[model samples]
Target: MNSNQKKLVKSTVPVLQTNGTDLTKHFYSRMFKHHPELKNLFNMSNQASGKQQHALAGAVLAYAEHIENPEVLINVLKSIGNKHVSLNISPEQYDIVGHHLISSIKEVLGEAASDDLIEAWTEAYNELAQIMISIEAELYQSNLKKEGGWKGWRTFIISEITEESSEVKSFYLKPKDQASIADYLPGQYLSVKLFIPALGHEQARQYSLSSAFNPEYYRISVKKESNGNVPEGVVSNMLHHKKTGDEIWVSAPSGVFHAGVESNQPLVLISGGIGITPLLSMLETNKKRLQENTTVWLHSCRNEKVHAFKDNVDRLNQDSEWLTTHVFYETLSQNGNDSVKEGRINLAELRDEVLIDDAKYYICGPEVFIKVQYDSLIKLGVAQEDILYEEFGPQLLHFN
Candidate 1:
């Protein structure tokens, strides 16, 4: 970037850091007023909670912070690019977003927003937008070049359904044309889009691939959330309403949460409730690869009745001497049978039960669960570089 661009980026950082929320609220309000159609494009719930708006503002500010050395922001850019691709956010939309963003900044900063400041922000936005567009284009090309990957949406027909639990069902998806699906690394996710009549247009959400990568089909286990207030996960709820042979739109696989098979160190997989889906894929993939090493799988669920894939884990443990599985049940049934543990997975109990030193840890679950596990891992002197995580929501902004 030129010195002028660098100056612009540096100047805006403080403004964004201080007034980002207000700027985002103003930006969204203005954008929606002009383009009411885009209201459906964003997560209204996230907007109401102020998470999505704050996340976007934080991202823009972070991007500006590294404008002089754009290479440092590659991973951040890639993550957002994947999300945008899933949301089907078009390049044209960037122009719309940029205009409102600049206008909001000017309106918020008032006297501080001089002619030079406006020019600098415009230049910075253009530069960042160019970077995003180029990166997204590369992602599009890579997916298309893959054996079974394609651009835009493709039809996947539900081949079968297996009951994982009373509330969870696993759907096996195969291309309607019987074409092979892209082979993804364990822990990757697929973006599924649904056309909701009430909401209009299409809404997309990412679900982790629960089964190991196979040419025949992909599997996703979804738990039905019937909470009276908040709406259930859009795509998941839609999938639940469909029957065998129903078709849905799915994007090619993408994510960076997979285990690093290249490393020879012991692997530790930690999960709670439905978070077990991705971890199971990793374990299954390792089993298929015949990777014999000390691997620990720690899973926590409310009770045995709701735990999915117990049989699969049991079979893997019996077959592989290197695999050890631990199950923590939060609610034990009546009678002191100890058949199910009666409380949340105690980090102290976990540390006492399992040895984690010299192992790479992968954690996934709700924000609070992940936070507890993460703090415990750090307390145990685990290196930050050795621990990785995948959040179900937009909580990446808080990470380093």
Candidate 2:
């Protein structure tokens, strides 16, 4: 873009910071109305809760603030690109999104909107879209080039289903063609798309792989979100209701959150509630391949009834000589008994148990919990580079 266009986009930074989510909310509604088929691509649950809008708002504001040096946002771009590739987002959809976004800006700003401002925004959107499309294309090409991999979605049959907990179940999915599946770095997630009859549309949701990468099958442990009256988690609930022998569409594992297999540093895996899925994969993979590395799993949940993989972790602990596991229950059981420590998983409380000073910490959980765990680890003298965490939805990370 020219200097004048850049200036126009920069001037709108304040407005976007203040009203970006509102604009994106309007944009999504308009797009979905005009292009109902897109409902299959987007997570309506996230849309309803405003997470998708908030995420877009953050990205837009960031782009506007860094328009002159777009490379500064390369990390964010890579993260979004990975997700887009997992969702099979194509470059052609950029035009559809741009059209609605511009319309939303015009509708939201009303008389305050100007032709020059809209034109400048159009250019900016195109530029950003091109960058994202290019990155996504690279990711797609890389994934397709991997052994036993293909582009777009593949059919996977649910060969087995195991109830891990009252709210969580593990679905063992194998390729429908009985072919080998591409291997993924431990801690990555799979994007599963299924048709939801209630919404009258197909929906895609990313579920962290709960086990180590295997050519035979992938395991995703889903926590059914059926609390209260909120209609969110439509796909998760659908998966919970599904049985073995059902076929589901799945994308190759994708995400930047994973342990570095090459690193020989001690590994610390911390998780809360169902967020343990990806971390479990990391722990399992570490045990299988990197047995020499010292590993510890620190987890928190409501209680035994809700803890998903206690038996699995117990088996790993018994088999591995260098592994230690700790569980923190939020509340006691019905019998008011507890075998592990009581209360939330606080890093400070377990400082003595943290044997390694320069260990790599991997965390996954709710937004607030992840932030707390990250900050706590920092306070414990862990270098920022040694700590990594993944937020399930739109990343709101502000790396210091």
Highest lDDT: which candidate?
2
lDDT of each: 0.80, 0.88
- Scored against the true structure, residue 132 in model 2 reaches a CA lDDT of 92
Against the true structure, whose TM-score is highest? 2
RMSD of each: 2.5, 1.8
Worst 10 residues of 1 by lDDT: 226-235
Clashes by residue pair, model 1: none
Tell me how far the alpha carbon of residue 230 in candidate 2 is from the true structure, in angstroms, after superposition: 6.5
